[model samples]
Target chain A: MSILAIQNLYVSFLENTVVKNVSMDIEEKKVTAIMGPSGCGKTTVLRSVNRMHELSAHASVTGKVLLRGEDLYALDAILVRRRIGMVFQRPNPFPTMSIYDNVVAGYLLNGLRLGKPELDNLVEESLSSAALWDEVKDSLRRRGAFLSGGQQQRLCIARALAMRPEILLLDEPTSALDPKATASIEELLVQLKKTVTILLVTHNIAQASRVSDFTAFMYLGELVEFGASAKMFTAPQDKRTEEYLTGKFG
Target chain B: MTFTEAAKTLLWRQSLDKVFFGVICFFSFLSVLPLVLILGYLLVKGVSALNWQFFCRVPQPLGEIGGGIANALLGSLILLAVAFLLAVPLGLLVGIYLAENKKNWLADCARLSVEILQSVPSIVIGLVVYTWLVLPLKTFSALAGGAALALMMLPVSVRSTEETLRLIPLELKEAALALGVPYYRTILRVIVPSGLSGIVTGVLLSLARVAGETAPLLFTAFGNPFLSLALFRPIESLPHLIFYYATSPYAEWHRLAWGASFVLVVGVLFLNLTAKFLTRRWRVRF
Candidate 1:
C-alpha cells in the first residue's frame, strides 16, 4: 500500500517555482529513489513531504501531502515531522552530545523520559540497526565528534532510527563520504528498508539502480518518469529519462 | 635581460624586505613595552603593600600602617556576581532569538539596540541607572551599580552569542529538528551547548571590561567605608576605591591605591587567560 502520496504539489521560493505540479505515491517498506541533476528541485520535493521546505523565509508550498490517507499539510508541521524523519547530505551528529546521547536525542528532546534500561535498549537497538553498535559500543560515553566520518554518518542514521518513524527521507546521504564509506551506506540503506519506507534523492544514477526498488527521474522542476526500478532503469518511457540514464546529460 | 642586473635588483629587494620585517618586529615590541613597564612598576611599588592583612581587614585612618581593601574586594565580587546573574541569561536568550529569526522585525530591533547600547558611555549608563533605579528606590544600592554594569555587559554578551551561534552550521539545527526535537529544546539543548566555548569567552571578556569600570559605581555604590553584603545597601568596589584613594593627599592612601590597581589588573588578566583556556579546552570543531 502507498504510505505517502504527493498530490499536485508546487513549491516556490519568492517568484521562482522550484517544484511544479509533481505527483507521486511512495509504497510502504520500499526504497524509492528520486534521481536528478543539481538544481532539478528533487531535494525541494523531498523536503515538502516533511513540510521542511518552508523553513526558508522566501520559500512557500501548495497542494497536499498525504501520509497513510491523512493529509499531512492539515496537521502540525512538528508532529508531521515526528512521523517522518530526514537525514542530510552531510553527517551532522550533535557535537556536544556523547555517542549514546545522540542516538536517544529524539526521545530526550521530546521530553519522553524512559527508564535507564529502556534507554539503553533503545540506543543499542537503533545503533545495531544502523550497523554502528560494534564500533561504538565500547565508547558510547565519548563525544560524537570523535567518531570518524563514516561512523558519524551512521550515528546520524541511528539518531533518526531511534525515533521509530514510519518513513525516512535521505538527501544525497553519501555525497560527503569516500567511495568505501559510500558503498557501506548504500548497503545499510538497502538493509534499512526492511523496517521503514525510504524516499531518497540522489544525483548518483548508479546508486539508484543498485539500492532503490523504484526510481523517479526528475528534470526542470517536474517528475519526467517513475516506475519500478528494473523497468525505469532498463526501459525508461520518457526520452529525457533515456538521456539521463545513458549519461547523455544529468 | 642581464644576469648581473637581475641579481642586483633581487638583492636590493631582499634587503628592503629585511628592513620592513625588522620594522614590524620593532613596533610589536614597542606595543608591549607599556605592559611590561607597568607590571615592573606595580611589582616594585604595590608588592610591599600586599600583606596577609590586605585581604582580610577593612581600611583604617590615614596614619595606620595595616589598613586593607577587604571591603572593596568583597564589594566588587558581589556586584559582579549580581551583574552576571542578571546579564548572562538575558543576553544569551536575545542572542539566540536574533540568530534564529534573522528576518523578524523584533530581531532587527534587538540587533540595532544592542549596537547602540554598546556604544553608550559607561558613565552615561550609570547616570541612567541612577535616575531609573536609585532615585525611585530612594537609596544608593548595589542593585543600581549591578544594573549599570549589566547594561554595559549586555552588548558584548549578545554580540558574542549571536556570532558564535551563527558560525555553527545550520545542519546541526536541522539534524536535531529532524529527530522531532521542538524548536526551543533544539536551541536550548543542542545549539547553545555547541556554541558554549565562544559564549563563555564573550561572557568572560565582558566581565573583564566591567571589572575595571569605576564611573558607574561612583554614583550608585557610592563607596561604603566598611564591608557590607546587603544588595540594597551602598558598597565599595576596587576601582572606585582606587579612584578615591589615588586622588587623596595622604601617601598611605596612594600606596593602597597602587595595590588596588595591581590587584584589578591581575584580576582582569586572569579572566582573559581563563577565556583563552576555555576556548582551547572546550571548543567543538566540526
Candidate 2:
C-alpha cells in the first residue's frame, strides 16, 4: 500500500512556478526514485515532502501531501519534519559535535532526554544500521569533521536514523562523493529501505535503476512517467521518459 | 620578444618585488616601534613603583613616597564586569537576528545602526551616557561609566558575531532543521556553538578597547581617590588614575601614573593574546 501521496502539488518561487501539478504515491518500506535533469524541480518535490521548502523566503506551495492517509500540510511543519527526516546533497555532520553526539543530535535538538544507556543503544543501533558502527565505534568521541567525506555522509545517515523517522528523503545525497563512496551509500540505501520508506531524488538514471523499486521521471516541472523500475527502464510510455532513459537528453 | 630580453624583464620584475617586500617589512617594523618604545619606557620608569603595596594600598598624599592604584585597578575590573554583563546577551541576540534574516528590513536597519555606533567618537558616547545616567542620578557613578563602555562594546561584538555566524554554511542549520529541530534550538544549539570562538574574540577585543578609555570615564566615573566597590558611587579606573596623576605636578604621582600605565597596557595586551589563542583553539572546522 502507498504510504505517502502527493496530490496536485504546485510549488513556486516568487512569480515563477517551479513544480506544476505533480502527483505521486510512495509505497511503504520501498525505495522510490525521482529522476530528472538539473533544475527539473525533482529536489523541490522531495524538499516539499518534509516541509523543508518553507525555509526559502519566497517559495510557496499549494498541494496536499498525505502521510499515512493524514494531510501533512494540516499538521505542524516541525512535527511533519520529525516524522520525515531529510539528508542533503552534501554530507553535513555538525562540526562541533562528536560522532556519538551527532547520532543523537535530533533528540538533543528536540529537547528530548533519554537515559544514558538508552542513548547509547540508540546510537549503536543507528550507526550499525547505517553500516558505520564498526568503523567509528572506537572513535565515537572524535569530532564528526575528522571523518572522510564518505564516512561523514554515513554519519549523517546514522544521525537521521537515530530519530527513527517513518520516511527518509534524500536529495542527490551521493552526488558530492567519489565513486567508491557513492557505491557504499547506494548499498546502504538498499539496505535502509527494508525498515523505512525512502524518496530519493537523483540525476543519475543508472542509480535509479540499480536501487529504486519504482522510478518517476520528471521533465521541466511535470511528472512525465512513473511505474515499476523494470517496466519504466525497458518500456517507457512517454517520449520524454524514453529520451531520458536512452540519454537523448537529461 | 627575444627569450633573453624576456628573461631580463622577468629579472627586473623580481628585483622590484624584492624591493617592495623590503619596504613593506621596514614600514611594518616602524609601525611596531612606538609600542615597543612605550613598553620599554614604562618598564624602566614604572618597575620601581610596582610592589606588594602598589597592588593593595590606596594612593597617598602628594608628599608621600609610596602609593598604589588599588582603587583604580579594582574599579576597572568592576566596570568591565558590568559592561560584559550588559553587552554580551544583547549583542549576541542582535547578531543572530541579523545573520538569520539578511534580507529583512529590520536587519538592514540594525546593520546600519551598528556601523554608525562603531564610528561614533567614544567621548560622545560618554557625554550621552553622562546626560542619560549621571544627570538623572545627579552624581557621577561607576554605573554610568560601565554603561558608556557597554555602548562602545556593542558594535564590535555584534558585527563580529554576525560575520562569524554568517560564515557558517547554511547547510549546518538545514541539517538541524531537517531533523525536526525547532528554529530557535537550531540557532542556539548548532549555530551559536559553531561560532563561539569568534564571538568570544569579539568580546575580549571590545573589552580591551574600552579598558584604557579615559575620556568616557572622565565625565561618568569622575575618579575617586579611595577604594570603593559601590556601583552608585564615583570610582577610579586605571586610565582615569593615569590621567589624573600624570597631569599633577608631583614627582611621586608621576611615578604612580607610569605604574598604572604599565598595568593597563599589560592587561589590554593579555586580553588580545588570550583572544588570539582561544580563537585558534576553539575554531570549529567543517
Candidate 3:
C-alpha cells in the first residue's frame, strides 16, 4: 500500500520555484531514494512532505500531499510534522541536553508525562532501534555535544524514532560522516525499512543504489526518471538519468 | 652587511620589544593605582566605625554617639528586591522578542528605545520617576526608588538576553520544532536554557550597576533617618546615606559615610564575582 502520495507538488521560495510540479507515490515500509546533483530540488521535495520548507521566510507551497489518502497540506503543519518526522543533513543533537534527554526530547517537548520506568524503556528502545544503545548506554547522562560526529547523527535518528512516526524523511543524513560511519548508517537504514517507510534525498548516487528499494533521478527542479533500483541502475530509460549515472557534468 | 652590524640591529630590535613590554606593564599598574589607594583609604577610615552596633541600630541624632547604617542597609535591600521583581522577567521577555524577530519594525524600535534608555542619565530617570510616581502618590517612597532602578536595569538585561539568544544557532530551534514542540515551549526549554549563562551574567551585572547609583534614589527615595519598612513612605538607601554623610560637615557623618562606602563596595564586588562564577559553572558552549 502507498503510504504517501504527491500530486503535482509545487514549492517556491519568493520568486524561485524550486520544486516544479512533481508527483510520486511512496510505498509502505520501503526505502525510496531521490538522487540528484546539487540545486536539483531533491531536498525541497522531501521537505514538502512534512512542510518543513514553510519554516523559511517567504516560502509558499501549492498542490496536494496525501498521507494515507488524506491531504497533508490541509492538516496542521505542526501535527503533520509529528506524524512524519524528519532528520536534517547536519547532526544537531541538542547541545544543552544529555544523551538520555536527547532521546526522549520529543516526548518532553510535547509535555507528555510518563512514569520514570516508561521513559527509561522508551529511551532504551529508541536508542537500540537506531543501533546506538550499546555504544552510549553507559554514558546516558553525558551531554550530547560530547559524542563523536557519527554517534551524534545516530542520536539524532534515535530522537526522531522516539516519536514512532509513520514515515521518516532524511535529507543527506550521512553526508557529514566518515566512510566507515556512512557504511553503518546505510546498513541501519536497510534494517529500519522493515517497520517504517523512508524517503531519502541524497547527492551520493552510490548511497542511493546501495540501500534503496526504488530510485528517482531529479535534475533542474524536475524528476526525470524513477524505477526499481536494479532497473534504474542497470538501464535508465531517460537520457538525463543515463548522463547523471555516467557522471556527465553532474 | 658585516656580522657585527647584523648583531647590532638584532640587539636594538630586542631592546625595543622589552621597552614596549615594560610600557604595557606600567600602564596596567597605573590603571589599578587609584583603586588600590581608594580601598586603602576607605579601609583605614571605615574599619574603626565597624562593629555589631553599627549593623543593628539605626542612625542616632547628630550629637549622639554609636549609630549604624542599619536603616540604609535594609532600605537598599528592600528597594533592590522590588526592582528585581519588576525588571528581570520583563527585560528577559523583551530580549527574547528582539532576538527572535531580528528584522521586524517592533524589534528595531524596541532596540533603539533600550539604547536610548541606557544612555539617559540615572538622575534624569530619577526626576522622571519622581514626577511620575512620587508626585502622583504624594510621597517619596521605596517603590518610586525601585521603579527608577528597574528602568536602569532594563537596558542591560534586555541587551544581554538578546545577544545571548542571538548567539544560539537557528538549527537548535528547528530541531525542536521538527519534534512537534510548540514555538514558545521550544524557546523556554531549549533557547533560554542554552543561553542561561549569559542571561544570568547580564542580570547580575545590571543589579550590581544599579545598586551603586545614588542620583536616581536622591529624587525618588528622598531620605529617612530612622528604620522603616513601608513602601509608601520615604526610605534611606546605602548610596543615598553615603551621599548625605560624605558631603556633611560633621566628622562622625564622614566616618559613617566611609563605612557605608566600604560595605556597598563589598556587596557590589560579591555580586560581580557570583556572575563570573555562574558563567564559568553553567556555561553551555555550542
| Index of the highest-TM-score prediction | 2
Model 1 CAPRI rating: medium
Residue pairs whose backbone atoms clash in candidate 2: none
Q: What is the per-residue lDDT of model 3 for residues B1-286, given as tens digits with 9 covering 90 to 100?
A: 8999999999999999999999999999999999899889888988888998889989989888889999999999999988998999999999999999989899999999999999999999999999999999999999999999999999999999999999998878888998888889999999999999999999999999999999999989998999999999999999999999999999989888989999998899899999999999998865
Q: How many residue pairs clash in each candidate at the backbone level?
A: 0, 0, 0
lDDT string, candidate 1, B1-286, tens digits: 6999999999999999999999999999999999999999988888888987888988997677778999999999999998999999999999998888888789999999999999999899999999998999999999999999999999999999999999999999888877767888889898999999999999999999999999999888888979899999999999999999999999988988999989999999999999999999998977
Stretches of model 1 off by over 4 angstroms after superposition: none
What lDDT is reached at residue B57 by model 2? 97
DockQ of 2: 0.90
**Best first by TM-score, ranked:** 2, 1, 3
The TM-score values for the models, in the order shown, are 0.97, 0.98, 0.96
Task: Report model 1's TM-score to 2 decimal places.
Answer: 0.97
Model 2 Cα shift for residue B125 (angstroms): 1.1
Ten consecutive residues with minimal summed lDDT in candidate 3 chain A? A47-56
Query: Residues B1-286, candidate 2, lDDT per residue (tens digit)?
Result: 9999999999999999999999999999999999999999989998878999999999987777887999999999999998898988999999999998898789999999999998999899999999999999999999999999999999989999999999999999999999999999999999999999999999999999999888889899888999999999999999999998999998889989999999999999999999999999999998
Which of the predicted structures, 1 or 2, would earn the higher DockQ when compared with the native?
2
TM-scores computed on chain B for all candidates: 0.98, 0.95, 0.97
